[model samples]
Target: MIHVLVTQAGHLEETSKQCCKMSETTSKHTSALCTMQSLHLVLLVVLTIFVYYVSKPHVTEVQPMNRFDVTNVSYTVSMAQPTDSIQRTAVSERTYVMVMSQKRSGSSFMGELFNQNPTVFFMFEPLRSLTSLAMKKTSFSFETAVHNTLNSIFKCELTHVPVSGWVVKKTEVSTCFNAFEMQNNSVLRQICSKYDLTGNQMFLNISSTLCKRRSHFAFKTIRITDLAHLKPFFVNDEFNIKVIHLVRDPRAVMNSRHLLHEENLDFIRRKGTHADEVKDLCQNMKVNIAYGQHIPDWLVGRYKLVRYEDLAEKPFQVTSDIYNYLGWILPQEVNTWILRNTDHDDDKAYSRTRDSRKTAQAWRKTMPFPDVLNIQNKCQDVMKLLGYVQFESRQSMRDAKSSCIPFNGYLNHI
Candidate 1:
């Protein structure tokens, strides 16, 4: 009986040991499963965070504010974000003005109107350098170059100029001086020296000075003909852009081209024959003028079509109206300059320096009757659209009974 009891006790001890081993094995398995689950959960969280970051909208560098008072103004610009390809945020408030016109269409004269304003930082034919740069960088489109350059100028972000994607030549900064005729301007000279851009430094670092002052920025471009091409600029909230679409009578434009060609026969020869040149010019004028006919709803207030004739015929009134349209208070200095410039009588053959008032009617006298007829015939539709009266015959002028209905479609604002 004692031997049987001892054997039973040994069996019980063996069972207990087996139970302990099983429990240790189960705990190890459970711990391994828990660790794997925790690892998976951590991985899932990391992936979620990465996806959220990747899906977020892209935000471009914020445009710097004007140095002047912008306490009351707020600008919101939408740009596609790089990461998620979504547009977010608003552009800052900086006024940008562009004079859109064709060559020899009184763009220079209109540009001068803005140039005379002390508050305006005017850049004339800024596209010339851009075009040159675009040619070198074949990968970059001309439109893109223009867009970037204009934005940089308006934002006073000079360092953004000669951007690798748009500009191939870093030394193109000298072009600005040539465009603005700043070589003799003392202020520009001082600024250049301040930036250490004098002498061998052809590239400009304009940020040190130009960006420090706040002013309304303006530029004139004859390079762009289609209004649609400027859509990017118009929609960009970074700039409160106003467009002045200047148009001249086709007859006047033709005559001016003819006269200019006559003066520079070599240039005319290089371009083409007189007829071909005039035909091309007239076609370009027609296409560009027609762009104004159907102004987009978004552009109604932002775009203004101004006839060179109207501006010349009624300088003060038209200018005042322009100022009002642009939401600018015509400064006393501007008024004084206008008065002083327009008061005099101009009698020059072909001088951009003459009193602009005389320039309005000079086209009528300068263009021969037959040539005027040709131009009128070529541009009849546009001429009529722009309120230019065409007499069927010279006799109709003497009769004073010719049908007279001025088509002032875009001029309703004036």
Candidate 2:
């Protein structure tokens, strides 16, 4: 009986030992499972964070406006989505210059004088975009469009520029225009790829950055008709504005316009006769010259008039005078560009390269005597103001040795 009771006790002890071993194995398996689940949760959180940042858009900072007091001008602000928006950075002071001229008056060549300078951020016919937009939108105010586009670009916020696709292709952004050659431009390409962008937006980032880096800002425009239209721009204390009003002989202008067959694009839409066109051109010039002559307090020391004939005659002197007037150094590269461009001949209508002296006088030889007489008759007042002499006869007009531009013209002093 004692042996049987001892056997039962041994069996119970073995059973209890087996139960303890099973409990230890189960606890170990549960702990390993919990650790694997925790690792997976941590990985999921890390992946979510990475995705949030990778998909985020780039942001650029720009300066906010203190005040843009344009009278009777209604400017529109850009309404791009926040994802594509550019924020304002700190405002840095810069010199703003506008090269205002009539088309075919050597404005393209004149603009290049500034465009070649690395120090100057140059824009070509930006208002031409405004002119296009104004045509489509009847509500558009010319003054408003001018101020809006200029204000945005001048401030280095390019998102709001009224740029059309045609302007993009023809102007400085692609192959670039009037200034800042973008043809085969590596910086522009890199910016586009880095931002994963296409079309005009590709230029937006690069242009704004470039604009800020430069000390001087110059734009050439033929859209603004009256000097009084820019009264608001001149008064703004935020900018140090200078105006270079470029004029040319009306006869030469008419001759160039005829070459392009651009009579339809003339500012005067009246009878469309050659005489009427010259009449309209002279009237605009007369008004602007009068304003410059009786300069206002705001425009004093700020407005300058340049004749295409004078610039063509004395490229270096006029350019130097212009740089001096603006308190800027005449870069050696500008001189080199002047040397190369002035002596060469290019058949392209908008070619900057030309024999400038020959070009200035080409109208005399190219235009018929009847056409010359008609222009002279209509633009006599303007010719007198700008120092162009009227020809007595066809023989005198044909005389290459006897020049029509007087040696003692108004531009001689400049």
Candidate 3:
């Protein structure tokens, strides 16, 4: 009976051992399945994140305002209701003036007439960067590019200007205070300080704030050959565009260009002989004057044809006339500047530093008699139309200076 009892006890111990082994195997399988499920969940989460990022829309670095189409359509900016304090501060009304001219036509000097005004924010030769930008986008015409750039500037949409080493170089940003006439401007300085413009940022990028308070936004350009290229802007109700078609006597223009080794003279010389060049210049002057004369009746009041000579010879009178035409009261600061700049001593050389009136007739004494006669012959009819009297002899040249009458035909028509 004792032997049987001991055997049964051993059998019970074996059963117990088998149960323990089975339990261990079950735990091992459960752990392995949990690990596999965990790994699959982690992989699914990673794939979801990856897919989200990959499927997202790409944001282009270039602004849409930089792109221009050739269609004769007007662009209108819809005024958004100001939701922010910053946007609400923008001026409700602004005037845009384009001082258009050919090279060596005293456009820069004329541009400064507007620039000296504290209310005016002037940009010089903004189109000089268009060539570089145009090379990248061959689909758009050069005129279209210019139009787009001007639109951006006029609307104070700086980001719209091509900022990738095309418009506003890094060096220009550093020296902008002087270049943009912001040295003495407290408001602009304060804005610059607030933004902490480090010259590394694009000029157009900062101009938004700089131009915020300005009533007049003026820019000078020599790239526009035809006034018709700007017709779209004129039709756009958003833009109150006043165009100053600054002209100079073709003889003086030619002489100044020749003396300064300007590109206009170089281009002409490359194309033809001296006489042919003068004749071409005469033809261009006539065409430009005709364009000015035949400006659309709607634009007659908006367009003003001002002779550089007239502006130089009679600074105050001419400036007053321009201001009156634009319906702007000439600021005291601008008047002071005009007086200071125009009252300097006469310098014979091609320079901005000279008596304004003397500078008007400097080309007469310097230009050779044969060249003078050639220019006179080519330009005679237009010159007469413009009220510029030709000299009969070298002695009469000096006498003709005091007697030279200013053109009032446009004034009468206007």
Candidate 4:
């Protein structure tokens, strides 16, 4: 009986030891599971953070604002010439304006609206010199030249601008030298600094001096085909840039081009009154207008799209609004200029002054019916977008003297 009792006690002790081993195994498994769950939770959090950052829109570095009393500041103008006007002002913030458009889009006329302002230093087709340079395959790439030249010009570094870009009258300088040639030959760079307008240093010095004194700078260009090309300037706060994207009706633009015997265009590889020409023109317009509509953060207040038709219909009203946008009053001189220019009709090919309202409607009366339809068919989407009315019949288009363009608030809002 005693041996049997001892054997029972030993069995019970072995069973307790086995039970402890099972408990320990279960505890280890529970610890591993908890560790894996914690790791998965940490990974999930990291992945979410990565996605959030990746999806956010990129923001450029913003310029520091100059805090000053607005009540004390005022914009003043000193008219230099009918062509050249310089503004002298107590305002610290310099305004840089660009009138961007395609050729024969009445850009020259539209530019006059800003150019007439005494408080503004304006250049006409500065990039036209660059276009001249592009034909020669100069040292600077087209993009580089455009960016550098504009950067220098806006900052009043006139010497850095291509000498060809400057408007020194042929009669003004007795000893003539080709600045474009000097630029291409690198003769100016070797003689002076890299960006010396060495052909006539005096004119360069004078223009630069006058430019530096101005509170505002404006330039018009038909060279820039894409709004995306100006992204660098838009992103840079130093520029304080305002873009006036001037767009005209494709049919009118084509008619003007054809009338001038402009068989070749800078943007088109081969140009004629064809599907390719109108298609390319409208496509360029569409891209520019689209960019203006869906403007990015950097371009928020800096960009505006101006329609030629609207400006022609009411030059004074539109010009006044433009001046107001620039935080300046429309001077009496600008109004006078507008009055003189818009009221009179001129036969000259490149005349800035014209019966502006009549000029806008000339296409309807002169352009061949088939040609108008061709443009309308090619640019149907752009026409719809810009609120241009397409004529269903030749008689309707030619006979109607009143404005065909409806007031599209979406396109021409101040």
User: Best by lDDT, which number?
Assistant: 2
Q: Which of candidates 2 and 4 reaches a greater TM-score?
A: 2
Question: In model 1, where is the ten-residue run with the lowest total lDDT?
Answer: 78-87
Per-candidate local distance difference test = 0.58, 0.70, 0.64, 0.68
Give the count of colliding residue pairs in each prediction.
6, 9, 0, 2
lDDT of 3 by residue, 1-414 (tens): 434544554565565455555656678766565555555555655665676677689985421121111121112222212124433333336677888887778887777677677677677676766654555554757788778888777767756666532233444545344433343233344444444444534334445544544666788877676677778888877678888877778778778878875445323322433447666656666666775667676476787888888888778888898888888889897788787777786454433445777777877777876777778888898777777778777777656445454646333442
Clashing pairs in 4: 87-119, 344-355
Candidate 2 ranges beyond 4 A from true positions: 1-92, 165-197, 263-275, 407-414
Which regions of candidate 4 deviate over 4 angstroms? 1-92, 138-140, 168-199, 263-265, 268-275, 409-414
Q: By the TM-score metric, which is better: model 1 or model 4?
A: 4
| C-alpha TM-scores of all predictions | 0.62, 0.71, 0.67, 0.69
Candidate 4 or 1, higher lDDT: 4
lDDT of 1 by residue, 110-135 (tens): 77677677666666666656554554
Worst 10 residues of 4 by lDDT: 73-82
lDDT of 4 by residue, 285-361 (tens): 99888876687787788778878888888888777777777777777878888888888876888787788888887
The model with the greater lDDT, 1 or 3, is 3
For 87-153, candidate 2 gives per-residue lDDT tens digits of 2222335678899888789998998888777677677777765655565666878788777888887
What TM-score does candidate 1 get on C-alpha atoms?
0.62
